[model samples]
Target: MYYTDRGIEELEGRRGEEEVSFAWLSDRLRTFTDLNPEFETAVDRLATWLARLDDDEDE
Candidate 1:
C-alpha cells in the first residue's frame, strides 16, 4: 500500500525476467541519482547495503 510499492510492482512487471550485470545496474543508479539529486542519500544507503550483503558484521 505504500507509494513505492507501485514503482516496485511496475519494475517487477516490466523487468522481472530480465538479467543485468552489476555494472549496468550501477550505471542506472548513477543516472537516477543524477536526475534525482534529492534521493542520492537513499540511493547511497541502498547501494552500500547491497554491497555489504555478504558481510558478517551484523546478523
Candidate 2:
C-alpha cells in the first residue's frame, strides 16, 4: 500500500526489480498498526507527505 507514485518508485528502486513481497509489507504494517490501530488513516497521512516530497523535489 505505497502512497505517492514517486515514493513507490523509490521503494522499488531500493528493492530492485522484484515485486514487493507480502512478508515485507506485513512486517511494516504490523509495526505501524501496533503503534496506531488506524492503519488506513496513517497511510493517508503518509501519502500526503510523499506528495509534498515530490513537489519539493520539483522545485
In model 2, the number of clashes is 0
Q: Indicate the residue-level lDDT of 19 in model 2.
A: 74
Runs in model 1 deviating more than 4 A are: 57-59
Candidate 2: residue pairs that collide: none
Encode model 2's per-residue lDDT on 4-51: one tens digit a residue.
788778977987776766577667766877788867677657656755
Candidate 1: C-alpha lDDT: 0.97
lDDT for 59 (candidate 2): 86
**Residues 1-59, candidate 1, lDDT per residue (tens digit)?**
99999999999999999999999999999999999999999999999999999887776
